[model samples]
Target chain A: MTHGTTSPHPAEPAPAPRRGRPRDAARDRALLDATLAVLAENGYGGLTTAAVAARAGVSTATLYRRWSSKEELVIAAAALHGESSYEQPGTGTLEGDLRVVLREKAAAMTGEPGRLIRALIGEAAHNTALAEALVTAFLQPLYDRVAEVVRRAVERGEIPPLDGVELLGEVVVGPVMTHFLLTPRLPEDVDQATARETADRLLPFALRAVGGTP
Target chain B: MTHGTTSPHPAEPAPAPRRGRPRDAARDRALLDATLAVLAENGYGGLTTAAVAARAGVSTATLYRRWSSKEELVIAAAALHGESSYEQPGTGTLEGDLRVVLREKAAAMTGEPGRLIRALIGEAAHNTALAEALVTAFLQPLYDRVAEVVRRAVERGEIPPLDGVELLGEVVVGPVMTHFLLTPRLPEDVDQATARETADRLLPFALRAVGGTP
Candidate 1:
C-alpha cells in the first residue's frame, strides 16, 4: 500500500465517522476494486482519483470523503485483500502443513490480489514510509504464518527447533524472489508444482543449513 | 540492478579499444570506489555522475569513458563490489557450509559493499536494465554455488535430491534479503555461533520440501 513518497501512518482513523448517511460499504468495495484494476493497467504514477472515481461510478467527493489521499486509498485497497485466518494443519508432518499454506498463497498471488501487491511494492521503493505501510499491510501476515509453523514444529519435537523460524522463512523465500525479480522466466515458484520441486532439491540444503534432519 | 520502467538491449558492447590511453584501469577502479563512497554517504537518488567523478579525482570524460548513464554507473558500482569469489568449506558436514556462507554474507552486508548492493536493489524499481545487470553480476553466482552443492549431494547420495534447486535457492535467500530490505533484524539462529542450531531446525523442512529423505 506504499503508494506515495510520504509519511505512512494512516491519517486519523477515518475521524470517527462524520454525520453522513451510513457510508455505503458497497461503494467502498467498488472503489477498492477499481483501484486494483487501474493499478494493474497503469503503474502507481498513473493512478488518479478522477479515474478511480469514474471507474468506481462514484463521485470525486465520495472518493475524497473516505480517503484523504491516494496513498491511503492504496493502503485500504491492499488491506481489503484476504482476511483468511491462518489454519495450523495438524498433519503431524511439516511438509503437509507447509504445502497447504504455500498453495493457498500461490493461488492468491496468481490473482488480482497479487498483481496489486506487486504494483504497491514497485512503487514503495521510491517511497520509504509508504513501503513500510505496504509491508505491514500485505507481507507481514505471510511472515507471521511461517513463523508460527516453525514454532509449532519445535513444540511438537518433530524437529530440534531453532531460535528463529523467521530464518527458515528467509532461506525459503530469498532465492525464489531473486530469480523472479531478475528474470521473467517464472514469476514466483509458489505453486504445488514449484513448491514440490523446491521441497525436493532445496529442502536438504535448507534443512542442513538450519540443522534439522529429515 | 533493477533497471525498471523500460530497457533497450545493451548498446552493442563498448566498441573495441580505439587508441585513447587504453582506458586507465586505475581510473576505473577509483571511479568505482568513488561510486560506493557516494552511495554510502548520500544514498541512491542523491547520487550523480558529476559527484562520483569529482570524488574519484577523474575528469567527467574519464567517468563517461566507463559508464554511459547514472543508472549504468550505479549498477556497475554494485557489481564491482569485489566479493566475487565463492568458497565451499571442506568441513565434511552440511552445517559447516551453511555457517561459512551465512556468516560471511552477513558480515559483508555490514560493510560498504553489502550496504551499497542493498541500496541498488532498492533502486531497482526505478530502473529496469540496471536491475538486470545487477542480478546477472551479483546474485547469479550465489544461485550457481547452491545449485552446484545440491547436484553434488544428489550424486553422493548424501540426501535424496528431488527437483528445483533454483527454487530452493530462493527459499534460502528470500527471507535473508527480505529482512535486510525492510528491517534491521535477521534470525540470530543463522548467526555464525548459532548456525548449527538454526540449521537443525531448517533441515527437515528444507529436506522434505525438496523431495529428499523418503
Candidate 2:
C-alpha cells in the first residue's frame, strides 16, 4: 500500500501532505527499537529484517520501505543508539574533559549500548560492509568529538601541539574498551561501579599517553 | 573402531597398551588444525564438530574421543595457536622488552591467528563459555607474560613498583588491539607494515602509561 493513508490532511492535501511524515517518523522509531532488541537477542549473524518487523508489530514491507536490508536497519539503529553517547565536553583541561568523556563511556558500557558494542565488534571482523558502516556512522563521529576535545586542550595550553594527536582516541578509550569488551567478564558482571573504577584507573594512563601530566 | 588399533605394543600383554599414545597425539594435532580451519571458515556460531571431523578426515566419534564438545575443541585449538604468540622477553629495559612483545603481536595480527582472534571475539559477546575460555586460555596467559616483563623492569629499577602494574597488559596492547580489531580496516588490509607502524606509534605511549621514561 502507498504511504498516503497517514497523511496529515486528506481533503486539502498538497500532493499527499508530505507522505506520512509524522506517522512515518514514529514507525521508524519503533522499527529501530525492534532492531536493537532483535540484535541483542539474536546477534548480527542471526538478526533478520522479518524478525525485526515482527517484533515491531509491522509488516516486512513496511520495514523494507525504510531500510533496504538488515545491515541498513542495524546501522541506522546503532547510529541512533550511539548518537548521544559521546558529547564534546569543555571541562577546561585535557584531563577534565577526558574524565567526563570516559565517565560517560563507562556509564554507557554498563547498559544496552555496551552489549551492542560487543556484538558489533564480534560481527565486524567478518562483515566488511557492517565494519565500514560502524566506522562511518559511529567511530568517525566519536573520533571527531575527541579531536575537538584535544583541540580545546591545545588551545588552552593544557598540552602542546602533539605530533600524533589523532591516535588519542584509541589511546584514551582502548584500555577501557579492552576491559569491558575484550575481557572475559560477562555483560551482567560489568556493573556501573566496576566500569567507573576501570575508567578511573585507566584515565591517568590515558592522560599520560596523550602527553599530559596526570 | 577402537583406539587400540594404533597401539605401539599390540602384544605387550597390557590392557590396551596405553591406547595408542603416539598415534593419538598426532591425531589430536590434526583434529585441532581442522577445528581452526572450520572455525575460520564458519565462525564460532557456524562451527560443527561434524564439519571439523570431515575436514580432518576422521569420524566424529574419533574427534569426540579427545574433545567432548565443539567448545572444548575450539578452546583447545585456540590455545594451541596462541601458545607460541607470546613469550617472556628479558630485553633488560622495559621499552626493549615491550617493543619485542608488541612487534610479535603486530605480526601475529596479520595472519590466521588474527582472523581467529576476531572470530572468537565476535562469538564471545554472546557465548559466555567461549568468552571464559578465551580469558582463561588466551588473555590470562598473555597478561601474565606482560606482567613478567613489567616485573623485570621493576627489578632493574627501570620504573618504580607501580600499584596497578597488572593493567599494563591492557595498556600496552589496548591501542594496538583497537587499531587492528575495532577499527574499520578489513583483516586483509592489516598487513605487517601497518601493524608494525601502529605498534611503534603506540610504544612511547605505552611506556609513558607504565610510568617509564619514554
Candidate 3:
C-alpha cells in the first residue's frame, strides 16, 4: 500500500528517525486519524498543520518533523483513509456485478473517506507528487478491481474482448465523479438512492460497451 | 454564453456593478485573459485574485468591485476562456462526427484553456458557486454540442433513439478528462497524437453505448 511518496505513517514509518528513536507507530496513527478528522470537518482549504497537531495532541513541530509539507501530509492521510476491504462481487453477469461494485464505491463516497478523496483530487491538480500518489495508491486499486471484473466477463465470452476494457472504470465511474464534484447537493443526499439511479442508467451503456446485451 | 452564477464577463456582464456605472467590457476580457495566463503558469492552488489583477493591469480592488469573490472571478474567466466556435460536425455518420467532435475537444485540453479548465475543476470540488458555474457554463455547452450530434444520429436511424443521448458526452469525454487531469504528463507532451489515440479508442465505445455498431 503506497501511503504516499513519503513514509510517515504507522504502516510505513520513515527508515531513519530524525529524533532519538523511530517515530512512534501509535503517534503516527493518531496524527493520520487527526488529519482525516480535520479533513472531514473542514475541506482541504481549511486543513492546516497546526490544527492537525492540536487535534492529534502533538506539537506542530512533530508534524513538520514527520512530513516535509502539508501536501505530503494530506496524501499520507488520503492513503490511510482510502484503505478499504472492497471485494469484487461475483454476480455471474457483468451488469449485475458492475451494479454491485459501483453501488459500493458510490456509497463510500458519501462519507468522510469520500470528502477526503475529493479534497485530495482537488489538491492533486496543483501538486504533482500528491497527484501521482493518488493515482498509484487511491485510484489504481479501484481501477484494478473494476478491470478484473471486466477481464472475467471477457474470458467467459459474456462480452466481446474489447481492446480498452481496462478503461472501463472511466465510463463506469466517471459520471458519479462528475456529479460529486460539480453538483451542489449535500453529501448525505448522495446516498443509495442517487447511487442506484446512476447505476441503473449507466450500467446498460457499460455492458453494451463490452458488447454485452444490456 | 452562460458566464456562471456571477457573470462579470462582457459576454454576460454582472447584473449591475456593485458601484460605478456598468463595468468596462474590455477590462472583463483582459482580466479573464490574465486569469487564464496565471492559471496556465500556476495551477489552481497558486491562483490568487491579486496575481490575476496584477497580470491584467488592474488593481485588486477593481476585480473585487465587479466579482464578489475569487471563485466567481475564476469561473467567469473559465467561461470566457471556454467560449469556442465549435460547430457540430455533420459527417453524416455518428462515429465520424463523434470522432471529429471528440478530437476537437481533446485537442483543446492540450493548451492554456485546457489548463484553466482543469484548475477550475479542481477548485470546483470545494467552491459551490464555481461548481455550479462550471456545470452551467463550461460543461453544459460542451455537452449540448455533443448531444446535438447524437440527436442527429438518432434522427438518421443510425442508432437507437436511446434516452439520455444528452449524456453521451459523459461517456465519450469522461475518459479523456480523466486522463488529462490524472496523468502527470507535461501539457506540451499531450499533443495531437495522444488526442487522436484517445478519440479513436473512446469513439467506438461511445458508439456502442448508443446502440450503434462500432
Compared with the true structure, all predictions reach lDDT values of 0.58, 0.76, 0.71
In model 2, what is the error at residue B40, expressed in angstroms?
3.5
How many steric clashes does model 2 contain? 1
lDDT of 3 by residue, B142-189 (tens): 778778888898889888777656556676666667666665554446
Candidate number with the higher DockQ (1 or 3): 3
Candidate 2 global CA lDDT score: 0.76
Error of 2 at B18 (Å): 7.0
Better model by TM-score: candidate 2 vs candidate 3: 2
Error of 1 at B92 (Å): 4.7
What residue runs in model 1 are displaced by over 4 Å at the alpha carbon?
Answer: A1-20, A45-70, A81-93, A108-115, A150-162, A166-168, A171-179, A182-214, B1-23, B37-64, B68-71, B82-92, B109-115, B149-162, B182-214
Model 2, first chain, TM-score of: 0.86
Give the range where candidate 2 chain B is weakest over 10 consecutive residues by summed lDDT.
B1-10
Compared with the true structure, what per-residue lDDT tens digits does model 2 show for residues A70-108? 777898887677767756787788888888888777766
Winner on TM-score (1 vs 2): 2
Which has the greatest TM-score? Answer: 2
Q: Write the per-residue lDDT of candidate 2 for residues B80-114, one digit (tens) a residue.
A: 77666756787788999888888877766666678
Best by lDDT: 2
In candidate 2 the C-alpha lDDT for residue B188 amounts to: 55
Score every model by TM-score.
0.69, 0.86, 0.80
Q: Which is the winner by TM-score between candidate 1 and candidate 3?
A: 3
lDDT of 1 by residue, B70-179 (tens): 87787666655634435554555444444444445554444445456556665664456766766666666665655665566667677675545556556544544555
What 10-residue stretch in candidate 3 chain B is worst by lDDT?
B1-10
Model 2, which residues run further than 4 Å from truth? A1-20, B1-20
